[model samples]
Target: MRIRLLGGLEVTSPDDRQVRFTTRKTSLLFAALVLAGRRGHRRDQLSELFWPGRADGQARNSLRQALVDIRRSFPPGEHATTYIDGDQDSVALIVDPDQTDISIFDLKLQSDRPSDLAIAADLYRGEMLAGEALADGMDEWFGPHQNKYEQKAQQLVERLSLALSQPGSPEETACEGLAERLLASDPTAEAAHRALMRIHTLRGHENAALRQFELCKALLKRHLGAEPEAQTTALAASLQAGKAGDLPLTAPKANAATGPKPPAPSVSTPLHDRPSVAVLPFQNLSGDPEQEYFADGIVEDITIALAQFRHLYVIARNSSFTYKGKAVDIKQVGRELGVRYVVEGSVRRTGDRLRIAGQLIDASTGAHLWADRFDGTLADVFDLQDQVAASIVGAITPKVEEAEIERAKRKPTESLDAYDYYLRGLAAFDRTITNRSSLEEALRLFMQAIERDPEFAVAYARAARCYATRKSNGWMIDRAQETGEATRLARRAVELGWDDAIALSYGGYVLGYVSGDLDASAACIERALVLNPHLAAAVGVSSWIKICSGEPEAAIEHASLAMRLSPFDPRLFAWQFNVGLAHFCAGRYDEAAAWAGKSMRHQPNYPSAMRVAAAGLAKAGRIAEAREMVARLCAFDPTLRISNLAEILPPFRRPDDRDRYIEALRIGGLPD
Candidate 1:
């Protein structure tokens, strides 16, 4: 018998018959244990996570009934212990390596080979436990695992795409096949789309390459209200203009968007260097004509923020808004505005909450650049407006910057060995994922970078950033000494690279987060934004300050915007924490608890998230659940105390807020 949890719950009998449980709670119980992987959960833990509303005795009784249902779905025998095993204390699913697809997928991902990655991609049928609606409580336990599997799938897509881009790889067809399957699930996946284009060009199928470009371009524009990045455009040009005798095999592969694509020899470049964008007024979907003002307000805010980007030419509001209430073609809008991108959306206000959905499109090809939805209480409608603006600007700038960075990296590496060290540091830094060992390794690489190039301000900023990370995570080895050192490095970064956005932003972060100088930090970040308004990290830091400084609403707006700006950013979980903190500070305990759940869902091992969630749940009147969260938090970090929270927390501008925070944590059962 085989257990399946990849798409949905199912058991394959030896006779090839499919067996599935009808009880939703039973399925959740089965999933909880299997997704736990090796760490078996105590029966009590499972009971509470799935049935928190029930009393302890009732919850345990419910768990017993679910377990009965789960066992009945499996093949008959004492083989019951072979599939599911548990004592009175704990329970878990034992994976049969040969029969389980996830085990094979996981094992294959451990290898760096492209073939292995492609094999793993084939096993991920869809979202984990797909087609099943997860209740609120189950999500806190199961969501992170689901995201991890999805991330693994994405990594596979990236590797296979890279393989297809290689000139003489024997697995081009196989890699393309796997990539297409992945794209079938997420059509807007830029890497997979690019891979298909590369595959066609490699085979000398010019028409296929052109068609793939149009398909990608059309989808991106139609869904996102934006266009393909310049790199994609230039690559399409390369495919089309290739001589009948020769093709460019080295179309830039999937990479962290940092730089630009080299234009094809026969193609003419755009007159301007920046991406041009027009912000169209959002449609009033609230069914109330009075909400038209709110919709228009969101568009205006987005326009202003986008106009701040030096690398993006934004159409004036007067021009963009002329098409209001008119069903103008996106392509026509693009031509009229002389812009490459157009932003559009709809707003619906239901009761006390407004839900806003927005998309960025390529005006010429109708390719979607980005799309997302924002939901929040109407009390903070202005904050919601800012979030929409931040999201759109965030979506467009990174890809352009990434292409530029890649181009810079592609230069001969011998003369630029210092930069090589810096690149290695960045790779290591990304691996940190808020872990101690990886962070230390990244710092070592950054140190080597500056040793080779004494003038590398970005390296200094990154080095200083290590201390700030430690500060954020409460991992400071020696608080005062680390803060002083971080300040020294930050000051050096500001002096050495006034124009470098990375240097300024990271430097500003250290100053604000560690050195406790908000004003100075603000100046550095402000200057960095002037240099590159699209620096998502800098915007997030700004939000952090607002959150701790008694401006919860502002912090949430900025944090949410920062998240939308770079959705795949590794540090996004940390930013989500800020959003939760902001809601908690604003006395929106329910919202705070919900966002806290989101942070933990993104990073299940994140300890701070437990604390925030506990505090919120306690304040929200879910005492039993809050106590449970506190127990988990203390198990993760035994030394945490309610009284000492101020040591880890930034000095709040409001004393009352500080008192409330501490009291809530205490009520949630934190020490002292």
Candidate 2:
């Protein structure tokens, strides 16, 4: 007998004669038994599975009748024992897995050989049992199986797309067919769309490739209400620019002398130094199937929270949720997802009480680094979820950082990619206390990162920030040239990083300070805060923008909130300076001077901190000390006189605020 279950249930005799089951239940039961292998399923379990909510004796009778019906479907006089075997306790199908198409497909998928994978691709004709009439509640049991096969098929096509990247290869056409089948199964499969785009581009069908990109974009927006990911967008852009061949789907074969080595498996060698993580769907232990939505919501919240961190590489929720309802090995998941960490959790509810438990695992080693449980009432479920997400992110961030630090130690500088260069630039930027040398190095490094990947938005923003620092310290030799360059970089950052909070934060600050565009700057900063309310840098920048706009109270409140979010933030000096400036604007001279003193202790030579200290001290009648601050500020930057103060400082929105600041500096004996 030959059994096929890919498109639908079909059985044939050795003479190619069609065989039909008397009832749909008998066919489903036969498929179930065949999938159960030689060990078979317990009669009680099968009864509960197929005839749920029925009495034990009645369900057993139904199962027996179904077995009889299945046996009768076979050739008569061939004996029921030939295909079906049972001895009261349980039942078995005497068919080898290799004899069935679905099982054969799975076995072929297990092999790493491309030829075997191609055959596996051919066997998955469509969704498993695509048009079979499942029982009313049978979908719950069947959905996972169908989804699992579909996910495997998607992976198979992507692997084949990368493997058969060459033009005019025989398998390339087969891979295209598999890609289309994947789209038929799931119209929202971006990977399938990307594969088709690349295949078309390789076959010199540029227009076809561009059309596929538009289709992917429309489908994503319609179904997900989101834009395509950065990778997909970059691929589409390359295709549009007629540089499709420059962005190969697979790495070129490496030669000993000149060619680059093949990508590694650590967090997908393409991401280079980035450490990726995935949060699997939290299991619903509440016994009520309805709570599945609650469990999924928790995972989604956690995934979004984790993605807010600029340095973390988080896998999308759609990809992570594919592991739902499966018993997965952590190592295998890590390898398949290209993530170093995996987060899994469970939600259990009893009465009005809720318990959410989560664990962070080092996927490479299967070691649990952190685990915690939160208890709350359903009335406060939203707050409970927020607490869970914050706890998980706060716990795992440091662990990920430690791992990345160690990885950086072992990585060669020659192999540094865009992300690595960006990280190095960030480190240099953080160490730039009052020296132009460190700031210069940070700018160069950031520019290098941008050169390596021109679409890197945050790198552009940070590089613009370096120019902002130079302007603040009076280090620019040619103000017009530097201002124009900073504006260009800042605008590019804003254009490219519409959805990135960190990029928006820094880019907004530079544009406001250097280009005097307060309205546009405020818009970008406000959007960044909306995107990630917990981002301390965005909060800090918003506070500075408020101060520039002469809203001292709002500025002070935002600065305080930023400090609370990151009390020991690397940019603590900047936060303190913002608070001081806000207090100065509010005419609280004593408090302003005190806060400015605190900022100076962190960065003594920062010209703005010195100016704020002098202005506050003079307004509070500390004559000698105020004059000393003025002298120190001038020693740092001789050109910073009251005459040119309007040109040097950030453009103030209120004339009264600017005049008051200048009057205070004049009282401190600044040069005319």
Q: Assess every candidate by TM-score.
A: 0.52, 0.52
Candidate 2 to native Cα RMSD, angstroms: 25.8
lDDT of 2 by residue, 353-407 (tens): 8878787777775555556677889898888877677666655665565556556
Segments in model 2 whose C-alpha atoms lie over 4 Å from true places: 1-273, 280-298, 308-312, 318-333, 342-381, 387-409, 601-604
lDDT per residue (tens digit) for residues 1-672 in model 1: 676777666667655778666688777777777766655677777887888888979999998888777666553365443356678867776656666777787788666677776677667777788878888877767776776666566545555654554555655756676667667777866656776776777776778878988998888666654456444565676666664233333233322452332222253324243457788878775556777888888888778776665445777888776666543456556665677778888786667878887776656655444566789888998887777667666765654344334433676756656666676677666654457788888888888889998998988999998877776566776778988999999999989878777788888878877788878888888788776666687778778778767899889888877786888676688789889989999999988888887787666647667777988999999999999998987876666787567766666778888888889889998889
Candidate 1 minimal-lDDT segment of 10 residues: 258-267
Off by over 4 Å in 1: 1-435, 448-459, 605-607, 614-634, 640-644, 663-672
Give the C-alpha miss distance for residue 494 in model 2, angstroms. 1.5
